[model samples]
Target: MTQLPGSYESYWMESVAGADHRALAAGLEVDVAVVGGGIAGICTAWELTRAGHSVAVLEADRIAAGVTGYTTAKLSSQHGLIYAQLLKSLGAEGARLYARSQQQAVEYVAEVSVQLGIDCELERVPAYAYAESSDQVEQIQAEAEAAREAGLPASFVTETGLPYPIAGAVRIEDQAQFHPRKYLLALASDMVGRGGHIYERTRVVSLDEGKPCRLTTEGGATVTARDVVVATHYPVFDRAMLFSRLEPSRELVIAASIPGEHDPQGMYITQEQNTRSVRTAPYGTGQRLLIVTGEKFKPGIGDVSRRYEELAAWTRDRFPGASITHRWAAQDNTTTDRLPYVGRFHPGAKHVYVATGFGAWGMSNGVMSGRLITAHITGQELPWSKLYDPTRLHPLREAPSLLKLQASVAKHFVGDRLPASHADSIEDIAPGTGAVVRVEGRRCAVYRDEDGDVQAVSARCTHLGCIVHFNDAERAWECPCHGSRFATDGTVVQGPANRPLEPRRLPTGTEDSDR
Candidate 1:
């Protein structure tokens, strides 16, 4: 497998200059406190500000640094073979509402981008879910029919502008794509201009629910608000055992400069067991960047590096002369029934809300969440509210999947603790890589930095005590149970984990004295 020159950075982040927002310094009060700076949070703040409410957005890091910054940015309602399944599980009416919500979200984003004069490279494009095999072709046809029934502009066709031929495909017209970060930064600026506050590097550690809720930040700052929106990619608080109900998954993305002037007219995704997504964006003068993404798996469950290798190999075979320019990965939560949770956090809970479980199609769902959540908070009714209500439960539909997800979590939680480490000392760790090692009879995560300095931290995740495994592709420690990721130095990257991994003191005289 061929390796790239630098560490992973998303093409979107590399191209756009990010917005600057200060962290919360002292206590403050607002009408609504949005606890994440990703798409959902920014959109929620924008909507609330327009509705004449004082809003504050608190981000653990800079804006758009979460899933939004790492997305494929396909703004479409064609989410694999989902419409057909939704018809069976949620019935015709429910499925129609789902399609309507997504379509509205697509229009909302395009309208806002134009209204703000944001140069996000927004374009109207068709999205295709194609099949390369006979069985999947039948599924694609069914999905097209179902999508049309649910009021989507979908049609079944055997021909697409793909590099290779597909057996069949469900093509949705008038869908779109854009530079997500650029659009989001514009919204952040608009919100701030309208008296909405945004604070970066300000992590909301905990929430106290009340008529006027209290949110405590990591730096001993408190934000009192009439309502709160937990838009963090994964809900930090498990008020309803959300950790068990949602299954976390990860996928890899790679951007390469095509050798020639070859470009696909539309975005395409395969419906095979191992899914692959393809799209392109303007790179420079008459040049385009081709993004190919796939290799989905549970975080920490497999060899992360092998997936990157497979992606590179696949790209080499298909786009023969393409060379990798950028590589990155994203993680998302999948609900038992596959619909996003987008309303109040739980039944009978009025002030606190959560928007999560976007699966892999977060671009549309994230925007839909903002609209739905803001409507609920301001005492307005949206047609799709009941459909996406976080408190709604379908015991019959959810029981089996819920049980399977929890079983997997239980297996990992107990099984990881009983395993013996292969390395007895820190010296076994390779430079620029990390692994679990036994130190003084304790399981410790050890990494040797590029400078040959050894760092060690507790192997257990701070979120739920699940053992974390090293992900070599991104060089981060990942929790298998709930998808919390940490840097080699133990800083939290993505979470349900609000705290960093516990640092360990090396035994006396054991450290390399090169320092």
Candidate 2:
């Protein structure tokens, strides 16, 4: 097998020595049960705990080890020319509310880190959305004007600190970059100190909504709470049909150690080259970690391994003398209208609230979600609550994007069933790789290891019955339809899909003879 450079683990996860919390082993009751232990859940739980509400956070895996740990960790409100679009779609007042909520999150993180004495390496830096192409210059200018109108400290500029040149840029100051895991882990610990409970490796499989919502874990442990916040990144319980409203995309990230003099000194992004985001974190003495993220594509679609290469090449070419030290991927969901759904889970639900679809700017948005959801549960009316309400109907604005997303999903669901999408026979399968092939006229996801051992699982995704595609980069079966992922042996990796893929046994005659 060809060796891949650097570790597959996230740099944030590797840098911090995290403390483990036990999984759910018995049933319990709390005032609030927060599902998902990443940024949103932990922040929500922490806020609730501080508010004198009994809260318990149930995590499918380790706290902050999921998407939170994999993020670029830029805590800024400059989410790539969004103010201009928000001004058009949501109007001036709505855009102002959006800016205020996000800017508050940035300030909130700084305040909390200082109050709690958590050295999260929070640094105040300017953020920029630059135009690499001349055609994008006008867009940048419009964004600058729109952002300033929305009350953000934004301005249009032609010069930046990037090694390469730019046409125009929208610069926003008083933003920040930090170590998310360190910050979140500290918050998790503080939540514990405040009598809040955290259970790791406890996956909630079902939710029974009522006056006091009930959640059942995969291990059969039960949690009943007066209110529930489904902060799961993809939302495990999608009673509101978020699968259609939200679109999932995975992006590649590469980090390299650069000399202190080479640090970018600020956060930057460009829509050119698919999507490029650049930021830096303090590393070992006199060194900085240059984190570059780009090559956004639908999960489970296309050549992810090649996308990694393309991102790496872009980094090497842009930052000379920088050696790639770590590589990882982060997945995010974008809503039809581009703003996150952060209030009530659905129109009918009374006790269930949801926070998802932050696009690619989860750091600030996640903090915003924590505060917004807390206010909702506590009956504190917030100015921006209605703006982020999941039930808000924007038919004219959302219809086009929603329809386009559903069409792509329908194509994947029905189109992948065709014969051409499958391999001819197991004999053609290569070692250390996986493919969907037909066995006895049934589609099976088969993988042959380098040792010539074979394993097969049903190709159907348990979430939506979409065919699973093998991701060579991650060595997992990914559902292109809804972003559910499973290991080659069929264990669920990420969700929206709660169950593992069923195992399949190949007929003896169909086995490759070389094995």
Candidate 3:
């Protein structure tokens, strides 16, 4: 087996320049305060600043270091066989509106990159959704038809640039791809140039909804703003039980260097059950990097190592000579109705807006979110605003999925409280792995770090008390209920859970076991 790179580092992170933003230190007032410094927050800040609004962005970490940095960075409206489902759940007009918004977002990114002279490796290419077997061909055909009806330039085709053969495919022309971090870095610079304040390592802990909204930081500093955008991949403030409504899934991504002669001409994704997304990025003057990503599962529910091995096997079988370069994983939220929530945080909360549940197509949706939220804040009307309104509901279409997700939450919430499946002593956990063990009758999360030290934390998720499972691949504690994740040392990594996992004291006898 090929040894994987150390701890989940994304290809974009290795290439992009870091932003030297300081943490929020004192109370301040701004026209708009945007939380989360990924693409959604940065784009929102850029748009608001462009409109002459004084915008302040408060990020728990550096800019573009979240989902944006980890994405496949395909800037396309061709979101894997979605139009057909949209045509069914939403009507034709709704589907068209979604298509229009996504296409406009793609164009907007291109326009911005060109206008800003950002060399983010932006390239225009066709996107394809293909089927490996005849059984899946009809879905591809239907998707092509639905896409065309929804204003996307799509057509049914059997021939593609992929190395593997396909039964059929839906090809969408003029789709684009780029290095998301580079693009966002340029935008962040422009936002600062326009008098926008962006603070890194500054986490917004609580929000007070009023005429002038107040956000309290983890450092005890306050930010008062007329409007606030909670663009933090998963909304941290769960005032309306947003966690229960959105289902979270984790997907693994791996990039490898391939022979220049075998570079694919377009981005492609499989339409079958085991979805595989494929795209190529320019590595050097004459070489290309092939990025293959898939293997999605409910967060904290699967064997992460096995999933990574499976993806690696799939890649080797297809491109035997490919050299593994980078590997990472990203978590995305999916709503019951298959559309994102990108408007007001909730009904009756006019000043607070949120954008989430983009599924796996956040490249375009993130940009659309920034544009949509900015429009609402600046008193400008957008046609597709109602479709993405967080308050909108389709009870009949959404009820089944919503109930299913809630049932899973209840099962894990109760199941995790019972007992540890394996009664192996905490010392049995090998180095570089983690497990839940009963410490003096209380379940605790125990991770044996690489340096042979044992790190323990309360297994209970700080969000809603759901028991968190150890993700061995990432060395993090992940909540099965609503996707809250924490590092082994008990710091919050992903949220909806703003508080870090509570540190636990190891039993006296367990301290020197590894020694």
Best by lDDT: 2
Clashes of 1: 0
Write candidate 1's Cα lDDT for 401-511 as tens digits. Answer: 999999999988998877577465677776778888878888898888888788989999999899998987788899999999999889999999999999998887555
Put down candidate 3 lDDT per residue, 317-392, tens digits, no spaces. 8878888888999888999888999999988797999999999899999999999999999899999999998898
Worst 10 residues of 2 by lDDT: 1-10
Tens-digit lDDT track for model 2 on 382-443?
A: 99999999998799999999999999999999999988846777878888788999888889
- Decide which is better by TM-score, 1 or 3: 3
Badly placed stretches (over 4 Å) of model 2 are 1-4, 509-512
- List, in order, the clash count of every candidate structure: 0, 0, 0
Instruction: List clashing residue pairs in candidate 2.
Output: none
Per-candidate TM-score against the hidden true structure: 0.97, 0.98, 0.98
User: After superposing candidate 3, which stretches have Cα over 4 Å from the reference?
Assistant: 5-8, 421-423
Please state the error at residue 272 of candidate 3 in Å. 2.8
Candidate 2, residue 258: lDDT? 91
